[model samples]
Target: MRSLAGLAALVAAASVFLYLLSTHLPPGPTRGPPGSAEEEEVEEDGGVQEYRLKFPSDLDELRELAEMLKFYNREHHGYVLLLFCSAYLYKQSFAIPGSSFLNMLAGAIFGPWEGLALACLLTTVGSTFCFLLSSAFGKQHVVQRFPEKVALLQRKVEENRSSLFFFLLFLRFFPMTPNWFLNITCPVLNIPMPIFFSSVFIGLIPYNFICVRTGSMLSEISSLDDIFSWGTLAQLLAIALMALLPGALIKRYGEAHLKVDGVDSNGPSRAEVKPVRERW
Candidate 1:
């Protein structure tokens, strides 16, 4: 059993390596050549195939890049090329923890609603890709390293292998579940791409909406940039605390009545807890 588990881990790792090797495009968002590119894909596949972002090699600085795009957009009718490149980079550069910066930039460049929408779309797509890659290569080792967290997410997924949308929704809505970890683990567990996508479709909308809309207001808004602002930080903390509420309640309710698993009927069982579906 251990051997088989090891083999599965090896295979998953190999799959991720292959995926990394297979892509040339910079990850998040890159520009498309407007109508012609769209037409080519439409003509070939009857529907356009969406590309997974890999990462940009050229621009080391975002502000400079944004300024260039701003200039081009002003010169032309719009900045579709910039949109494409930005999206491509955002999606491909999975290592960066990019929300606050991206939101601010989007607001500065794109205004509120559209800027927000773009952020949400870019994030969802990028996040999904990361999930796939991580699940393919790192989930096995990830599970080994963080068994508790892995089990928590596994139960969440097990309930919805046939319903990824529900699973994604559950994970997204529930602040307790680790969204990043789940993304990587889902593929390794063989949740179909379509199903994985269904989860994204339903799950990401609300948070996306919130962040993007808030960002869109950036052009008109002027506030401090404290990472730990009072109001917003308090709200975030509240949400985190709210998720822990259930466990707290359960513990308080059963504190005195809890029994040892290995105890015989007459007394406390001392069976070694070799990990058996303990929920947090």
Candidate 2:
């Protein structure tokens, strides 16, 4: 009950903050002319009513918003940064979609380097918030909901305890696993906060750079599919494989050494490997 209350308070506070912050943003694009399709509706009585339809907050709306903001970004750069970071964090903490659009917008408006930096920083911070939130209020529920997955992840964590950092890097660098799953499961697996932080920060760089660069080239992109061609995925997979190599090497060599020394792979240590006494 206490945890639930805390979660509620946190959500309420975030909502209020976002509401206040949004008040400062420039007005949305002006409505189209009176006879525009968006503003025209046919009534049952055969009369044409001008009823403007509000756009939902989705990729298309986000892109339109980004386009509107581009005109004012240079003059109100600081406010724009604050707005962008706040919106990104809110969406991430709540597991909302459309961050892909935000990533691209960042590149389009801020350019590649600045956009990448912002996206990376905001992503780490937002993901960390979600991690802490789940640790505090949602871990048990998530574990109960996905017991098999949790069990599998637990075994993987135990098996790779010595190479956990590299495992995390591989997970982040490759999008084979969803990041929200990692954020929620890491706490349940008892992964150290520092390891989680470092893995998320460092591991996401390559992928985020790709997203940001794609955003910078938004003008040329006809769809999201264009951003991640086979070539791009191959490059990302190559980097992920490289990240896993060091850990694999360490584990392989350690096992070989243990085998050579007559140490039980999963049992007693070298000290226990002694000759038996002749006397019964």
- TM-score of each candidate structure, all chains considered together: 0.49, 0.68
Model 1 residue 77 CA deviation (Å) reads 8.3
Residue 279 in candidate 1, Cα distance off native in Å: 21
lDDT of 1: 0.49
Off by over 4 Å in 1: 1-73, 76-95, 159-164, 222-280
What tens digits encode model 2's per-residue C-alpha lDDT throughout 132-206? 998888877776666555555565566678878777766676544578778877888888999999998887776
- C-alpha lDDT (0 to 100) for residue 103 of candidate 2: 82
TM-score of 1: 0.49
* Candidate 2: Cα lDDT at 111: 82
Where does candidate 2 have its weakest 10-residue lDDT segment?
258-267
Query: RMSD per prediction, one decimal?
Result: 13.1, 11.0
CA lDDT of each prediction against the hidden true structure: 0.49, 0.67
